[model samples]
Target: MIRDKIRELLKKNAEAETNFSLEKPERAEFGDYAANLALVLAKERKENPRKIAEDLIGKIKGNREADIFEKIEIAGPGFINFFLNKDAVLEEFKKLSKLKTLLKFKTPKSKIQIEFISVNPTGELHIGHGRGAFYGEALSQVLKLTDYKVEKEYFINDSKESSQIKELGKTVLDEGTSYLTENLKSQISKLKTKIKNLKLEKPKNLYGEAGYLIAEEIQKDNKKFIEKELGIKFNNWISEEKNLRQKNYFNKILEILKNKNLVYKKQGAFWLKTSQFGDDEDRVIVRTSGEPTYFLSDIAYHFQKIERGYKKIIEIWGADHQGHQKRLFAVKKALDWQVDMEILISQVVTIKKGEEIKKMSKRKGEVILLKDLLAEVGKDAARWFYLQKSLDTHMEFDIELAKKREEKNPVYYVQYGHARMASILRKAKSGKISPPATFTFAEDAEILLIKKILEVFDVLEDAIKDYQVHRILSYIYELVYVFSVFYRDIRVLDSKQERERLFLVKETKKILANLLRLIGVAAPERM
Candidate 1:
């Protein structure tokens, strides 16, 4: 909102179209906000940048009468720096008492569907899947907090023809009917122990029977480990098997593709003209063996999503499926759907303990389970570590660091700041201290903490626009660090400034709690 107000003023004062950049100045002396509009307009209009900045400042001063800004200055060739009035800043701090009502952000009235961690129901969820689950859950919370109608979904890849499911069946049959490899032997032993009635004899349709058993086990594990342990609840659990069984669903999709001239039969196989829609090559929807490929089912699933009337659909996919993105987009183009669809690819998670990199392979039964990881650290630490990094980049999750109870751990540090603030408030309340009608911020640390506290709203807005949830981590970390400095340098209990300091501590705690909750991490009152 602050950035928007500044942009409006810049646009109104500019004579021509200009693309400018606005951001907080790195140094405190530079000002609270900085804009490069004069530099951009001067480059476009061939005018002196300093002169343009002066002219823009004049217009801003003439148009704005409110005491929102304390000072506006030009510096360093063309940049315009703005300082907010201290009264305005304090007013924002006061509003934090009713933050939810005061910061009622306006968002578009549209339904959005977010599908994430939709792994095939063939095995237990690994650490990589945990990353996706945490990221998706945190993103959903962020969107909801910003006033968006959000639907979180888990798309189960459990079709009968799935290659993974078929492999699982083969594994089960091999273990049941013959000697099992060391890799799969343990899993089959566990499965047999769990399902007492599981027959050791090979069935007539081993693939179907074994696949069903494994899929059922996977679903059960997902409910217990993923949903319950990790606290991620899905609004929809879409089953590919169910969708595939829907009468005429696949056939209807084929017909739609045929009507659009997007599919053709050749060499006893059906192909979609994906290359025409920016894909590298045409992709097969149906094989020569008379079985539909997984791609066809995926297209149908997306169609179902659109049919449900979502204005936007966001798919959080693993980086391994990056190549499939274009083909899916081609399917959307073939259907001529007007809805917005985005595929957010999450990179791999590399787990490490000290200097040793832990190898993870699900098929080999050599992977860190999500439940095990949650047990090792905690839900809050796991979620924080998983989400504190960018989704598009590889993350190295250090087990030892995550388990630490010191400042080296970011989650602990942030949560400690919150706990520390809560202690301060309790002390103030016990002492019957009340905030003064007016206050003065004399200490540099005090002013710095207030400035950092005021920045959460801007950070939240930027995260919503860019879908970069990691930025919130950076903001809260800095806020906590500043608060730590304030606590160490300034006294709070039994001082003349005790009440005023308590107010700042309370506001800081609110922001820290909000940010932690947004990331689905707990904000403990005591550590």
Candidate 2:
């Protein structure tokens, strides 16, 4: 809101239209906020940047906008730095009572559908899949809090694959016939654990029946683990096989492409003209064997999403699908769809022990499964570690660091800050002392802490726009770091201004709790 007010003031005085950047100055002497409007305007208008900054300052000073800033100065080449008035900062803090309402004004509400963790119902979800799961859920939470109508979806790929079917058949047969090799025993044990209702009797169509049963068991287990262990609940579970069975759905997609002149028969296969829309080569939608390819099914699935009338569709995918993004976008272009679509690719996650990096391969049966990771550290620690980094950056999960219970662990450090604040609030409640109307923060640490707290709404607003939920982690770490300093240097319960300090502590606790909830982590009241 403060940034908006400053932008409004700058826009009224500028000679030409330009996109300006307002950010916190890196140095304390620069000011609370800095704008690079003069630099931008200078490049466009061919004027001295410092002169442009001076002129902007003159116009702002002439208006006598005392409530916004106490001082405005030109710094560096063209940067305009503004020191916010202390009273204005205090007024912003007072609005914390209506914080939720304040956040709603930051973004336009829209109906959005986000699909993530749509792994095939063939095997257990490994730690790689956990990254997308954590990222998607956190993004969904932020969107919901920011007033978007969000539909969290998991697309189940239950269509039959011949190789997978045979594998399932062998496993089931091995278990049923009691030829229990170590690997077969392990597979049967895991299957039984995941699918409590599994009845592995020998059927006439061995592979077909076995595949169906395996997929059913996987879908059930995946849903339970996601909802109960990971604390994520999807609004919709869209089954690909079910959608494929819908009357003429696949046919409708082919017809749409044909009408657009985007399909062709080449080498005894039906190909989509993906190269015309920017793909490296044309892609086959239907193979020479007369069976539709996975690409065709994906196109139909997106068409179904479009028909559902969502304004935006977001897909969280793994890095392995990086090359598929262009083909998917080409399909959207071929269909001339109006809905906005975004594909976010989460990079690989490597788990590390003390000195050795653990390599994982589900096919090789040498992998850290999601359930195992959850069991090792916990849902809270796992989610926090996965969500703390950018989705596009490859991350290494340090098992040792995650297991630590002290300040060295970021999750523990943040939770400890909340627990400490909760303790302070509990003490204040027991004393039955109301916070003072007139407050004075004599300590510099208290002022810094308030500044950090006031910046959270802006940080969250940026996170929503950029879809970089990692920013929330950075903000929490900084907020808690400031709080740690304040807690160490300033006395709250036994201070001369106990009630006012307690008020600050209470506000900090609320923010910590809200942030933890956004990332799907628990903010424990006690360490």
Candidate 3:
């Protein structure tokens, strides 16, 4: 609201005709805030910036528009900086105190289905898979926290893909396929024929794991290793094989698109006229081989989601799927649906041992399973490490850093800060210590910690809207570092201000616990 008022005043002034940007001053020696509007205006008007800044400062002295700023100054290169009363900074703490009883953001009031990490049922999850699992799960948590109607979905790609088709064909033929042996193939064929002929309940791969038996066996220990390491879970596991084949849904969707003339047969295969809807090129829905492309069944699955009544569909995909976004949007446009879709692209992860990079592959034995990372550094450490960097940036999983498991570890640092707060609280409870009636800031360290801690709410909202989970991670790590330094420099318990310390410690724990829970990290009592 305050920011809006500033923008309005800047827009009203004809001479100060540029956009206003409020920034904190470089140092305490200067004003607490700065704006570079004069510099922008000078460039536009072709005048000296300093003279323009001076004119604005003089005008601002009596202007009610500048009331939000306690002090404003013209800094180097015609920058206007403002300093507000300390109460402005303290206001955040008051908000934090009330956070226990209040909600900050309004609800979207629409159900959201986010499908992610639907890694094929073919292999164990790797570090790359962990990125999607963490980001998607964290994004879901943030939305829920902000009061969005959200559901987590895992689209199990068990059918129609090259990988799945190969696996299924191999399984049906029983040509050394993993789970579908000769006996299993015969059983499945008999069941398939039975389903076609009988009106009774048809048998199926009720044991989905049975299909992945061979792949799992080859990477048996590695699969367990990855799961234990990543903490990945799905609320809904929708099997494409089951969903695509459900009453011939794929054909049913194609029929609808065909009737709409949104689909066309070209080059001996069916193609979706995605280019008509601004896609780079028309996408093939069915290959010349008579097999439906993954996009064809994807349309069916998306239609299934729409049928389920989700107004919003969010997908978390790896960077490699960047080009896949246009086609998905094309489906939405072709169907004439108002459903909103947001796809977050998670960058790749690199495994490093000491200083050497260790390449990982799911097919090759060279893969470093998620479980391996967990075994080496524990879950909290691994997650913190994985999420510490922005999803848009490639993450290097440093084995040496994780192996240290020291206070230097990003996760351990945050947990230790939380643990330290817990320790302070325990001391207060044990000693029955209390402070003055009125809450007040004392030491510089105490104020610094409070300031940093209060920013989590803002960061949470920012990450949710921008789809930037890494910002939350960065904020938490910074908060922890600040708190740790403050904790070391100042005594929190057994002092005249012990009650206030107890309050801060309690609030700190609340934030740490909530944030850690959201990011799939553990805020341990002791570390």
Best by lDDT: 2
Candidate 1 lDDT at 229 equals: 86
Give the least accurate 10-residue stretch of model 3, judged by summed lDDT: 198-207
lDDT against the true structure, per candidate, is 0.81, 0.81, 0.70
* lDDT tens readout by residue for model 3, 343-428: 88888798888779976654454666665576777777777777778888888988788767577777767777888777777767
**Candidate 2 all-Cα RMSD:** 3.7
Candidate 2 residues 350-425, lDDT tens each? Answer: 9998999986765566767898888989888899999999999999999889999999999999998899888888
Q: Scored by Cα lDDT, where does model 1 land?
A: 0.81
| TM agreement with the true structure for every prediction | 0.92, 0.91, 0.80
Residue pairs that clash (backbone atoms under 3 angstroms), model 3: 33-81, 33-82, 34-81, 35-80, 225-371, 226-371
Measured on C-alpha atoms, candidate 2 has an lDDT of: 0.81
